[model samples]
Target: MLTLYVDAAREPNTGLSAAGAVLIHQKAQQQFKSPVFQSLDNHAAEFQGLIWALEQLTDHQDILTVYSDSKLLIEALHKHYAKHYQDQVDRILFLLASHRLVFSQWLPEKDNLGAHNLALQALKNRQTND
Candidate 1:
C-alpha cells in the first residue's frame, strides 16, 4: 500500500499559491512541493497538490491512500460537487480508478503539518523568485 499526505497554501494578498505532498511507498518516503501553475485559491491548490502526487506514481501500487487537510477535496471525491472545478476533480478520479484500490481520508492540520510546511516553503520560493 502507498500513502500520500498532501497540502497547499495561498497568500491572500499575492494570490501566490503552492502545493506539497509526502509520499510513503513501502519503506521509503518522498516529499515534493511546487508553486501552483496557475493563480488559484487555497482549495484549488489542495486539489492540484493531490494531482501532482498522483502523477508521480511509477510502479502501480495495488492499494493507495491519500491524506489531505482540505475538506473540499475529500468531499468532492466522495460525492458530486460543483461544476466549477469538475475537470480537476475528474482528473483525480481518473487517476484513482487506475489503481486496484483507492482511499481518500481527511487529516487534521496538526497531523498534516509536514506537508503544510512544505507548501508554505513552496509559496516562499515563489515569493523569492518574484
Candidate 2:
C-alpha cells in the first residue's frame, strides 16, 4: 500500500503558509515530498497539503492511504458530506472518491515528524527566498 504523510505551517507574522506532503510506498521504499505555498489558515493549509498530494498521485485507483496530524482536517474529511470550506472540502472528497483513497489521523508529532519538519523548512526557505 502507498502511504502519504502530510503537514503544514504558517510563518509567524506572515500570512503565507506552506503545506508539505510525503508519500511513502512501503513495498518500493520510496518517498516523495511536495511543498506548496498556501494562502489560508492552519486548517486550510492542511487541506491544501492533501489536495496537493492527490494532484501528485499518478494512479487514481491505487490502494493509497493518507496520514494527517490535523484532527479537524480528518474529521472534516470523514463527514458524510462536506461542510464549511465547502469548495476545498468538496475537491478533496472528490479526489478521495475518484482515487479510492483511504485516510486516517495520527496524533503524536513523531508519526508526522518528517512532514512537519519539512513544512517548517519549506516555510523558512520561502522566507529566505523572499
Candidate 3:
C-alpha cells in the first residue's frame, strides 16, 4: 500500500509558507518541499502542498492513502467543501480525480514529523532567501 504524509508551515511573523510531503511504498520513497510563493496561511499552504504532492504522482495508478495534520485540509477533502479555501479545495479535488483511489486522513501533529520538518525547512529557506 502506498502511503503519503503531508504538512505545511508558516512563519507567523512573515507569513512565509511552504508545503511538505512524503510518499512511501515498501522500499520506494519520495520527499517534497514546495514553497508557496504567495503569502498564505498555514491552512492554505497545506492545500498547496497537497497539490504539489499529488502532481508528483500523476503517473501513479493505485490506491494512495494520504495523512496530514491539518484538519482543514482533511475535512475539506472528505466533504469536498471549504469556505475561505474553496478554490484550494477544488484544486485538490481536481488533482485527486486523476488518481484511482486516494484517501485524505488526519493524524496528530507529532505523528507527521517528516512532512512537518520539511515544511519548516522550506519556509526557512524561502525566508532566508527572500
Candidate 4:
C-alpha cells in the first residue's frame, strides 16, 4: 500500500501558508513541502497540501491512503463537496481521477509530527525568502 501523510501550516502574522507531506511506498519514504501561492484559511490550506502531495506521485498505485489532520479535507474528498471550498474540491477530484483507489483518514496531530514540522518549515522558508 502506498501511504501519504499530509499537513499544512499557516502563519497568521505573515498571512502565509504551506503544504507538507511524507510519501511512503515499499518501505521507502520521501518528504516534501511547498509554499502555497495564496494565503487561505486552515481548511483551504489543508486542501492545497493534499493537492500538492497528490501531484508529487509519479505513477499509479493499487491503493493509496492519505493521512491528514484536517477533517474538512478528508470529508470533502469523501463527499466530493465543500461549501466554501468547492473549487478546491473539484481540483482534488480531477487529480484523483487517475488513481485506482484512494482514501483519506483523519490523523491525530501528535502522530503527524513529520508533516506538521515540514509545513512549518515551508512557511518559515517562504517567510525568509521574502
Say which candidate scores most in TM-score: 4
In model 2, which runs have C-alpha deviations exceeding 4 angstroms?
29-36, 80-83
lDDT value, candidate 1, whole model: 0.83
What TM-scores do the predictions have?
0.90, 0.85, 0.90, 0.93
- The candidate 4 region of ten consecutive residues with least summed lDDT is 35-44
**Ten-residue segment with the worst summed lDDT in candidate 1?**
34-43
* Winning candidate number (lDDT): 4
Q: Could you give the candidate ranking by TM-score, starting with the highest? A: 4, 1, 3, 2
Which scores higher on lDDT, 2 or 3? 3
Which tens-of-lDDT digit does each residue in 73-96 have in candidate 4? 888888999999999899989988
Per-model lDDT: 0.83, 0.73, 0.83, 0.86
Residue 76 error, candidate 1, Å: 0.8
Cα lDDT for residue 3, model 4? 91
Residue 13 lDDT (model 2): 65
User: What's the C-alpha lDDT at position 16 in model 2?
Assistant: 75
Worst 10 residues of 3 by lDDT: 35-44
lDDT of 2 by residue, 1-130 (tens): 6787888887656657776777776555434445547555777777877787788777677677878888877777777344656778888887878655576666766788877887888788878987
